[model samples]
Target: MPRIRSLFNPSGKMDKLVFVDSTKYGNHTRRAPRPGLKKGEPALKRQFSRTKYLNDLAGELNSAFRGIWPAKKSDLYQKMLKRFRKEPENRRGLLLMQLKSMEINPRYTFNSLGTCSTTVKELEESVSVGLQVQAHPPRGKYDANTYYYEVILFTWDDPNDTAFWSRQYSDWIRIGKDYPNPVFEFLFPKPSGTTLQWLLCLRVHLGVEDVVFPVLTTTGMQITDVGTFDKDEIRILEQRKQEEEKAKKKAKAAVDDIVRVKAKNQQ
Candidate 1:
């Protein structure tokens, strides 16, 4: 006698999940274009200007760090000081962490884009940004082999509405070991009253696998303080993540909905 196995699982279909941590991927090898000099001018002049700007910024950060670490007497600063002590070798990293704690805005130049390089230009109503994903070899055996990356251009309007992520652009780019880099252009809708900022979101998933969830990676054109994001907005983002997870748990289609949208557009 043998135990009879059920044909279907009582817990329902299992969702396929693949998490790709962008930080683990590290930065791309390709370099941004350097500022060029005319025939008679020397390159050192431009170099000196950049170095001077960096030094000034570093000095400002150092001043702020000193004000908080030793001089300020507070429980929060005391805890931070303990962590800061651990990074005795990495001054720059410690400075960045301090800046984050202080809610300081990061300097975002036109060259902030990662492997997917972009350029920004001013527009009448919306900002225009061009994205070009650079092709590269897969990281490891666990890396996705057959996948389509989705690009969503979004603008946050009403805080109360769950549909704040009104998809301005919905498209997908198929990628693998040999796929070519895809070029995409998006226009984020401008907001009305307050300052309007546009976010470009990239998500990827296996095209052939059913019950699969997407791995999201995002970047934006606007340069603002990290701590400025509202709690309501953060809640909405968390809700979006939950919805994605729920969809995966209940997904029955072989190809994800995003891939279908791209294919439908092609037709």
Candidate 2:
């Protein structure tokens, strides 16, 4: 019977089997993940439950800001503001995520994250607005070939606010989830005739559509100078993007036709 070898040298000229010291050639161990780096299930539940009432409020606010600045008194903002002020309790620590380019220019690809809190704690509010988008393979309800995503909006304000612990998110949609982004509008409670500066952090998960994982986390800010917004601009930008995409497809088709003709001649 032949016995299996415990150790062997590649030289094949050993007088006897020699033991090799594995400890002499060791690799570094990976660093441990930071605390709460990827932990937030209970947090998500709190966020969803608290925001269930705010969904309608958000829609109304978005509609109010849909058109031009210096809106009329009868505008949606005025109507919604009345409703906001009448609500029983004020919900602070609202973290907001917005796709900036969709409101500006398509060539611009920056997104934004911001939060709202007590005026006295403005600095804390600015520092705590960090949110990230994460993706997972299509599962259950996310049955399309496209990957499903979870966007977590974090705030450092009063830990009591459910949203302070949970993440706010949008409906899972395939459209406007990629580059050449979507027009995003966030509505927050603000006093009339005031300008406030907020610090924010935005993290985009790159390569999610292709099953690869990487994230780009950035910090910046935006100023809310007025309550009015122009919805017409968004429509114009969307039309422009559609036209540009059509032009590119036309040029590619022409090139493909030329290549096919050349190949036929060669044959």
Candidate 3:
């Protein structure tokens, strides 16, 4: 039987292990995440739960924004393994993964974290669609409040996560749980990042940083009917996106064919 190693040396030789707690940084530096996570704050222990949620959300949003849904919305966002088992390989998996992402959760609704609260601390009823898409000044009820926001409409989130895209790479597959988990990053150049400045500013002004949407932890998550205003917004965005995608694919195909023929002639 063989035993494992414990120490090492500077001369590239073996030596005893040494334990050192090194800061070299500052105090306000983050501590082990206390189930709370904010940008810029450094913590030794990562917010793993948040990590999983963000990864899954990024996967869903990236595809959903691109207008690709494989199964009925109900079956689409389940964990990859569970989703494949219930739906067809062709009709299921990545197709739905993409589709689920493209969807914008309703205003009275939310996905992942929780559902919308019927109450708001403040709003400009002056801007009529009062119950619909308009974002208010702040919620008066709580000392601090966070409102859910989505760029295209009711779905609330920073669009940066949406930018990590699958392009001319036409073939799509479900990000599998068993395989080396693929990390999805949608990079937003410069001020283009949707999650950071704009959304965060609005959320902070509304004092919602301390609040959490109630639906995420609840057992049953419900989907509300898309209202007249919400429906129009969703339809317009989807149509525009579909048109853009078709144009892109057509252009890519033409370039690919030309390149192939030119290579063949050269050969």
Clashes of each: 0, 3, 22
Top candidate by lDDT: 1
TM-score of each: 0.29, 0.21, 0.19
> Model 3 lDDT vs. the true structure?
0.31
Order by TM-score, highest first:
1, 2, 3
Off by over 4 Å in 2: 1-187, 193-200, 203-229, 259-267
Clashing pairs in 1: none
Q: Which tens-of-lDDT digit does each residue in 1-267 have in candidate 1?
A: 954554542332224333322344532233333345342267676556545544543444344434422322234333444444443223232222333322111231112322455554446776566766775324233343444433443333343221123234325444454567777776655565322223343433342232232322121122111111345544655776899988887685544444523566675
Tens digits of lDDT, candidate 2, 121-160? 2222122222223332222233322322222222322223
C-alpha lDDT values of all predictions: 0.39, 0.32, 0.31
Two-way lDDT contest, 1 vs 2, winner: 1
Q: Write the per-residue lDDT of candidate 3 for residues 63-121, one digit (tens) a residue.
A: 55336322224433444334333323222112223233222332312333322222111
